[model samples]
Target: MTESTAPETGTPSGATGNRKPTPNGTTPEPVDTSATETSAAEPTAAATTADGASVETGEAGTAAATTPPRKRAARSPRTTTSRARSTANPSNETPAPDAAGEPSASAEQPGSVSIPQARHAAPDEVDSAAPADVEDAPGDTVDGDEVGSAATPVQGGGGVVDDGAERPVVLRLTDVVKTFPGVRALDGVQLEVRAGEVHCLLGQNGAGKSTLIKVLSGAHQPDSGVVEWLGEQVRFANPQAANKAGIATIYQELDLVDDLSIGENAFLGHEPKVAGFVKRGTINRRTREILTRLGHGEIAPNRMVRTLPAAGKQVVSMARALSHEARLIIMDEPSAVLAHDEVENLFRIIRELTAQGIAVIYISHRLEEIREIGDRVTVLKDGRTTAASLPARTTPTRDLVSRMTGRSIEYVFPTRVNAPTEPEELLRVEGLGRAGEFDDISLTVGKGEIVGIAGLVGSGRSELLETIFGARQPEQGRIYVKGKALRPGAVGAAVRAGLGMAPEERKAQALLLGEPIYRNMTLSTFSKIAKFGFTDTGKEREEAMKVADQLELRPRDVRRPVRTLSGGNQQKVVVGRWLLGDTDLLLLDEPTRGVDVGARAELYQVIHALAAQGVGVLLVSSEVPEVLGLSDRVLVMREGRMVRHARAEELDEETVLDLVMAGSLMEGAPA
Candidate 1:
C-alpha cells in the first residue's frame, strides 16, 4: 500500500551562544534538508505514525470507496479528540486494533484505522506518540553555535540516542516570551526535547526554568512565540489540557492532596467511573500495577498521602504521571528529596520508561545526577535560554556552571575543617526512643563539632532529629542541651534550652512562609528585641537585617515575604532565624535538600562558620559526600537504628553505605 500524504514539519533549531537573535513574532529559517525530504504542503485525510500505523482522520479520501470509516461514537463533553503526530520512520509494530466498545474494523479490511492511545479505552493502545509532527510558526531565535563539551556529565546521558538517526523532536518552543508587570519571565526562550531523551533544564534559583515549565505545562500562556507540542500548534487552556495532550509535569512541590489515598491521588481528576460513580477498586488495582512497574510495590494504593515519607510521596507523584500515560514527563528537581538508594531506583525507573520510548524532562541541581540521567541539557539564566540541547554526558561542569550562574563556580562544596578535640559537649541523647520510628538513638554533639547522620529515606534520621528538638515525645528517652534536661514533647522548651532546629521539610515544618523575612527571622529572639515589655518593630528588623546580611541573602530585603524567596534563600532564612539567637546546639535536617550546587556550597560554609563559633551542629543529609565532607563525626542509621558511629574522616562513602544497608556497626567502630 502507498503511504498517505501529510504535513511535514521542518527541523527545530537549538539555541546557541553566538547566533544572531531572531526578530519578535518570527522564527529562524527552516533547517536545510535533503531533496528527498517530504514537502510541507502535502495533504491527506489519514494520520501516518512513526511506527507505520495509520489513523484515519474523520474525513473521506480515495480509500473511502471500499473502506467505510468507523462509526463516530458518542463522546462526553469533557472528552478531547486524540491528536495524531507525523511519522519519523515507518514502524513495523502494529497499531492497536480498533478499541473495544467504540468501533472495530477487521484486519482483512483495506482501511483499518488505529485509535489514538489516550482516547482509547484499552491501556495497551497507547505508544509513546509517533514522532509528533512539527509545525513551523514564528518564534524566538538564539546564537546558534554548537557546543563541544555536552558529553561530560558523569551521571545523565538519559539513553542511547539513535546513532543511526537522531529521534525526531516531539516538542519545540520558538521565541516564547512571557511577561508580568515588572518581569519578563520568559524572554525569547527556545527549547527542543527529542523523543526518548532525558532533556535536563538547569539554572540558578531566579532563572526562568520554572516559568518555562509552567508555560509547557499550560499553567502560563506565553505572551508571544509558538509552542508546537507533539508537532502541532496548541495553546493549552490549563494544566488539565496539557495533561490531556500527553504532557505531564511533576512539580518540585507536588500537587497531590494529603487527604487523598494513593490511588485517588494518582487518578484524581480522571478517576475510573461506572455510571458516573467512581470505581475505587479499579483505580486502586491499576495504580498498584503502575507503582509496581516503577519498582515500588510496597506502597499500598489505599494508603493516605499524608502518611507517606518524602520519597514515598515522590513515588506517588510519579505513579500519578504514569497513570496518565504521559508520553513526555517533565520532572522538576525529582531527586532533591531522594536518598542515594532511592535516586538509583529513580534512575532505574527512568531507564525503564525511556526504553519504552517515553521521553523525560529531568531537572536537578546535582551535576553528577545530570551526568548519569540526562541525554541533553538546556541552561536558563534570568529569563532566557543560555545554552540549549547540549549533549548531557559530554558537557563539562565548568561550562554548565558558568551557564547557570553566569560565572564559573570553582567549588561545589566548602572547605572542610577538623573540629577541636577538646570541644565542650553541647547536646546528648540518652537512650532516645521513638516508637515505630527510631529506637535507642543516642548521640552527642560537642561544641564546634559537626555531627552528620547518613541514612536511606526511611531510616528515621528526620524523626530522630525532630524528637531531639522536642517536636515529638520519645516513648523512652531523654534529650539534654549542655547537660540540661529538656521537657518532653515541647518545642518551646527546646528553644528555651538553647537548641534550634532547621527541619527537613522547610516549607511545611519550618519557617512562617507567608510572613515577612524579618518577622520570621525575629521569631527566635522576639523577647530580646522587645523594649521594656513593648515590642519594637525597628529593633526587630535591625537585628534580622544583621543576620540576613551575614548570610548574604539575596534581594537584601527583609520586608519581602519568606515565600517569595528561592529554595536556597528559604533555607538561609531558616538557618538565619537560628543565627539571631544564642543557640548552643543546632539540628539541621537535609539542610540543602532542594538547593542548587552553588547554594549548597554557601550553606555548607554557613554551617561550618556557625560550628567554628563554638555552636554544635547535628545534621542529617542523604548525600554521603555532604555528610562526610561537613561533619567532624558520622552516624549511620538504617530502619530506625543507629547502627554505626565513626569519625567522619575515617569512613568513606562505600563504608557508610555498607553500614547503612547492613544495619550494623563497622569493626572497631564506636557502638
Candidate 2:
C-alpha cells in the first residue's frame, strides 16, 4: 500500500513529481522532473526520491517497498555476502532458476521457516494472501475486498470461496525488471494476486516466472522494483525475511533433507529445542497432525525422508511449509512427481488451503492441471507479462500454450513406423523375478520396437527397469541383450552387453549434475575413448559431441556443466551419454517426466529417430497417455505382476488406467 501524506499544496515530498532531491539534504527545492520520463521505467534503486519514498526498479537486489533510506541499510541481515558472491557467479556460468519457483544460482541457502509456535492456529485475517503481482494491468485489476476478505473453509472441489468478485490485493508490483549480463530475466513484468485466490503463474522454461518468484521469496534481491506486501511497500532481503513475512516456497527440486526424519525436516531451521536438545515428542506429534490434516495420516512422522516415495516426499515438503505458518505457498511443478490419483489428492489439498484464505502461487507446464486447479492465470513470455487477467478454466488451451512457447502447439506424437514383420530380437527378459519387488515379469523387445509400461507408483514398474539396467539383481530371470546374457546386478556387464538405461530419477540416479557435459556423457565410455591406458580427453570430447549433436543439445557447448541446463536439456544429456556407446537396446523410464511441451516434442522426435535406427526402446511412464502415444506395445503392471499386454493402437488411456488400477480393463484379459 502506498503510504504517503498528502502535501498541503504542491507535489508531496519524495513524490518524484517535478522535483529531483539531491542526496545532500537540500533546502525544500522544486527541481522540475516529469513522471512521464519515469513512466518508461522507474529510476535506479540507488536513487531515492526526496519525499521519503525510494524508487526500486526490478526484482533482484532491490528493497521490498522503498524503505526509509536509513532503514534500507539493514536489508537482508542474515544473507551471507560470501554465499551471495559464490551463487551470483557460478564459475563463469549464467545463474538460472532452480525450480519453476526455484532460486537462481546461490550459495547454501539457510533454512528460513520456523516451527509453528501455534500449530493449530488459524491465520489472522489481517494478512492471509499471496505475494505481489505487479502493475501495468491497465483496467483488469480485481478489487479483492469486493470478494471475501475473510477466507474461511468451504467444502469439496469448489475452489476458494471467492464469489467471482474482485479480491483484496495482497501483493502488488510495478514494472518489475531483472537482467543478467546478456539477458533480461524480467522485462517490466506486471502481476497481481488477491486474497483467497489461486494465481497460476504460467510460462515455458526460461520465462521469468521462476525469477519473479525468487525475487518475491527474497532469495534474489531485484535489480530495482516496488514490492508491495499486504498494503505496504516493503522489501524482503533474504528467504528468511520472506518466510517470516508469511510467504512459503516449495521449489520443484524439493529442498527436503533426505538424511533426516520427517519430523526433523519439518522443523529443521526452528526446531523445538531447549537447552541444546530438541523436543522430539512435540515435533513428531505436531508433524503427525499436519500430515493427518493434509489427508496423509498414513505417513509416519518418524519415518526417514529418503524412504518415502516421490508423492510422500512432496507431502513432507508441504508439511514443512505448514510448520512455517505460511499465508501463501508457492508450488513449483508440484504435480511432476505425482501419478494420476496422487494429482487428484494434491488438488484436494490445494482447494482446502485456498478455502482457508491462504493464497497459492502454482507454477506448472501442464495446462490440464492448471484448468483443474488454477483460478486467475498469468502468462510470462520471454521474461515479460504477455497475458494477465486470463481465466484459467475459460482460457483456450491453444491461446495459453501459444503465449508460453510463442507458437501454437498440437498435442501430436511422432508417427510410429511399421517395422519389418520378422524383426530381429534386441532384448529378451524371461521369468524376471526380483524378490518382493517384481516377479515372473517376462517381456521382449524386437528391433525398432518401442515398448511402454504403464502402472501405479508402487506397481514395480521402476523396479523392473532397474533390474534390466543391472542396478538391482533379479532373483530368477535372464536378461539377454542381442544374444549375450547380462550378469545380474552388474552395471558394467549390462553396458558391455549393448544395454543403456535413463532411470526414473534423472537428478539422483542418472546425471552427475555438477559435472561438465563431456565428462558425464563419456563416463560410461572411458574405456572406449582411452588410449595407451590413459584417458584421451580429445577422443572423449569427440565422442560426446557426436551424441550431443545427434540430440541437438542447446548452446552446443560440451564443456558446460549439466546443472546449468533446464530439466529437458538435462534429460537430453542423460540420454546422450548412452548414445556414445554400442547401445542397441535403450531403457527410458519416465523419459519426459519434467520436460516442457516444446522440449517434450523434441524428446519424442529423438526417441523416434533412435527407433528408426533399429534401437529397441523400452519406455515407462505414469502418464497413460504418453505410453499410449509413444509405444507400439504396452505392458500394464499391477503390484508385482504384469496385468495386461496389448498393442498401443488397440488400447486407450482409459483402458490403461483401468488396467493399472483394477488389474484388468473393461474387456481385456485379467491379471
Best candidate according to TM-score: 2
Q: Roughly what TM-score does model 2 have, to 2 decimal places?
A: 0.73
Q: Lowest summed lDDT over 10 consecutive residues: which window, candidate 2?
A: 81-90
Q: Write the per-residue lDDT of candidate 2 for residues 29-83, one digit (tens) a residue.
A: 2111111121112334443332223334443223222321110010111111110
Off by over 4 Å in 2: 1-164, 256-316, 417-422, 664-671
* Candidate 1, 75-110: lDDT as tens digits: 111211111010001101111111112111235222
Each model's lDDT comes to 0.65, 0.64
Lowest lDDT 10-mer window, candidate 1?
83-92
TM-score of every candidate: 0.72, 0.73
Please give the distance, in angstroms, between residue 118's alpha carbon in candidate 1 and its true position after superposition: 17
